[model samples]
Target: MIILGIDPGIADTGFGVISAEKSTFKAITYGTIKTSKADDLAKRLDYLYKDIEKLIKKHKPSKIGIESIFFAKNAKTAITIAHARGICLLAAQQAKAQIHEYTPLQIKQALTGYGAADKNQIQQMVKTILNLKEIPKPDDAADALACAICCAQTKQYV
Candidate 1:
């Protein structure tokens, strides 16, 4: 199965694509969609929407896995991220892909066998699972990959 994972943000949205069969995983693509702070919030969301649409078109993933919005200290920041996430969901819907949402704890648990695992641990697991030369970059990208890995693991158990 080909899965597209998303770590949503207004400034730097992360995306990862992976093909998984049983316990095997192949990393297809991983990157961040960056928007300038100079741009308006609406424009940043538009950029995210367009970029995600392009990714869905290019890869034609069977499903999309996205990080669920976690409460942050800053309410404004959370709201902004929520907006971006909404657009991301819309993009997946438009692409006609099955969507699944996972929490950060769930992703870490799936990848590293520890619900409280740190970022480094999760990234290391992602690299090892995919047999990559290096950890996926830009933190957000790694998180996105972790989400995809979480979905793959969940599918296996189910």
Candidate 2:
């Protein structure tokens, strides 16, 4: 099965694509989608949507694992992230892929066996689990890979 994982953000959305069969997993691709703050919100979202749609069309992943928004002290920031996340969801839906949502805590625990694991810990685990020579560049991309691994480990898919 091919799975795509997304870590959504207004400025940078991270994406990781992996192929899984039984207990084996392989990283197909991973990267970040960047948008400048200089652009208007509508334009940024449109760009994000189009890029994500292109990814779906190219990879044709059967399932998508997306991190759910965690509300911070800043409500405005959370709302912006929600908008980016919604674009990701819309792209997945348009592609007719099964969507799976995982909270930050769930992803961390699944990846590092600790809900409060730090970013470094999660990144290390992602590299080790994927058997990569180096940790995926950009923290967001590693987080996205963690999401994919988490979804694959879930009983629903197993």
Q: Which regions of candidate 1 fall more than 4 Å away from where they truly are?
A: 156-158
**Residue-level error in angstroms, candidate 1, position 115:** 0.6
lDDT of each: 0.92, 0.92
| lDDT value, residue 23 of candidate 2 | 88
Worst 10 residues of 1 by lDDT: 149-158
Model 1 earns a TM-score of: 0.96
lDDT of 2 by residue, 1-158 (tens): 99999999999999999998998989999999999999999999999999999989999998899999866679999999999999999999989999999999999989888999999999999898889999999988988999999888876743
Q: Give me the overall lDDT of model 1.
A: 0.92
TM-score of each: 0.96, 0.96
Q: What TM-score number comes out for model 2?
A: 0.96
Worst 10 residues of 2 by lDDT: 149-158
* Residue runs of model 2 more than 4 Å from their true location after superposition: none
- Give the clash count for each candidate: 0, 0
